[model samples]
Target: MDSYICQFPGCFKQYKNRCNLKRHEEAFHTENKKFQCVHCKKILSSKQNLKEHEFIHTNQTPYVCREPGCGLRFRHGSQHSAHKRIHVAIKNIVNRSSVVSFKLSNIEEDIEEEINPKDMMDFTLPLIKRSQDYILPVI
Candidate 1:
C-alpha cells in the first residue's frame, strides 16, 4: 500500500498515480471540500483552496449579465436574471412623513434633525463588514 501526500492538510488518502488521486477526490473529497486542487485538475477539498484557485483564475470570470433597473452587479447571468424577477417595476412615492406622538417620560425632546435614508446607504456600504477584516495580518 503506497501513501500519497494530500495537498489538503487534514485529508487521509493513499494513492500512487494520477488515476488513483482522481478516484480518491471523486469518492471522498468532491462535495465535502470547499475547493478543488488546480494542479490535480480536481475540485478542491477545502473551501480555502477553492477561493485561492478563484484568485488565480480571476480573469476567467465569464458569468455576467445585467438586470434591468438593478444597476448591473452580479457574477453570472443567472444571478442577474434572478435579480430582474425580484426588483420589479413598482412606483414608490415618498409622501411627507407624518410624526406620530409617542410619549416617553424619561427622554428629553432635544432630537431635532431627521435621519436621511440616502445618507445611511452612503455610510452603510463601507460598514457591511467582511470576514477578511478580522483575519490577523500575515506578516
Candidate 2:
C-alpha cells in the first residue's frame, strides 16, 4: 500500500519497502560492494551476483545448443536462447535456394571451427603402412 522512492538524480525508481530501496541504491548508486571474488578479486554486491561472476574464472558452459551441427556452448540460458535465433533465421533463409547454399557454406565453416575434433566420434588419426624391413630395430 506504500512506496519508497529512490532520491538519486535522474532515477526515480519506486520500491514497495525501505529494504528493497536500500538494496537498489547499494547495487546501482554506490560502490559499497560486499562480496569479493576469490579468483579475480572482483567485488560484487550479493552472493548470487558473485556466483554468476565466478563462472568466467571457471570456464563453465552449462547451457549448450542442441542443434544438429551447432553444439555451441554458453554460460547463461539467455545467451543460449539468443543463439537459437540465428539457427531459426538460417532455416527461414533456406527456403531461398540460391542464398541458402552461399550462406550455409560460410556458416558450416564457422561451426566446424567451433567444434572440437577430439569430441567427434568419427575423428581419427591417419595410419601409415610400413613393411617389416622398413621397421628398423631401435639402438
Candidate 3:
C-alpha cells in the first residue's frame, strides 16, 4: 500500500490511497470551514470568516490607521489598507501642487485636537448603519 501524504506545512497525516488523500485535503486543508461560533452560533465558512465574525462581538479595533490625524480603526486589515490608499492619493495631490507642502503630522495634530470621542461616535454610527444594509442574510 502506497502512502499519500498531505503537503500542507505541519500537516503530516498520511493516507493509503490518492482518493483518501484528496478527501482529507478537501476536508481539512480546503478553505471550507465547519466550525460554529459559541457566542452567536453562526456557522462561518472559513477561518478568516470566523476571525472577522468574532470581532463583531468585541468593541476593540485592532487595525488602526497610523496616518496621524486619521485615527480611524478597522476590524479588518483590508479595510484599513483601503482607507490608507485615500491618504496616499491625497498626499500625491498635495505634493504635485505649488501650495505650501503641509506635513501630515502637523495637520493631524490640529485635527486630532478638534476631534472628540462624541464626534468619532457620530461618524461611526452612519458607517455601522450603512454596513448593516449590505450584510448577507444568515442562511
Candidate 4:
C-alpha cells in the first residue's frame, strides 16, 4: 500500500490512507477553522483542539501537585508529570544532604532562605508568570 505524504512545509507526516491524510491536511494546513473559541476568539480546525484551547481562557488547571507549599497546576497530564519530577529531584537532594537529623524546623529554615531568581532558574522548573496574558496561535 502506498502512503500519502503531507505537503505542508516542515511537516513530514504520512498516512497509510488518503482519507487520513486529507484529515491531517484539513487540521494542520488549511486556513479555514471550523471550531472557534468564544473567550479568546481563537480559531481551530477540530473540536479536540478547541477543547484544549478553552483551558487557557478558563484558567482551569485540574492537575495540581500534592507537595506541601507547592501549589503548581498544569493543564496537560504530560506537563503535570514533568512538574512532579522536580519535586522528586528536590526530595532526593534533601535526603542526600549532610543534614542527618531531617527535622521539620531545619527544613523550614532552609526553605525560608532567599535564593536569587537566576539560581532558581538553574533547576529548570516551569515558572509561569500569571501577570501576563498568554497568546495562543491560530490554526
| Candidate of highest lDDT | 2
Scored by lDDT, model 3 comes in at 0.71
lDDT of 1 by residue, 11-122 (tens): 8665667665764575465676545565556676645345545655563443443444446555444456666655452211111111112222123255434556677677
What would the per-residue lDDT of candidate 4 be over residues 44-125, giving only the tens digit for each residue?
8877667767999888887889899998888865588889999998776555443444454477689766766678667775
Per-residue error (Å), model 4, residue 7: 14
TM-score of each: 0.22, 0.41, 0.46, 0.39
- Candidate 4, superposed: residue stretches over 4 Å from native: 1-36, 45-49, 98-139
lDDT of each: 0.49, 0.78, 0.71, 0.76
Cand. 4 Cα-lDDT: 0.76
Among residues 3 or more apart in sequence or in different chains, the pairs in candidate 4 whose N, CA or C atoms overlap within 3 Å are: none
Candidates in descending TM-score order = 3, 2, 4, 1
Which stretch of 10 consecutive residues in model 3 shows the poorest summed lDDT? 130-139
Q: What's every prediction's RMSD, in angstroms?
A: 16.6, 19.4, 18.5, 15.2
TM-score of 1: 0.22
Q: Determine which window of 10 residues in candidate 1 has minimal summed lDDT.
A: 91-100
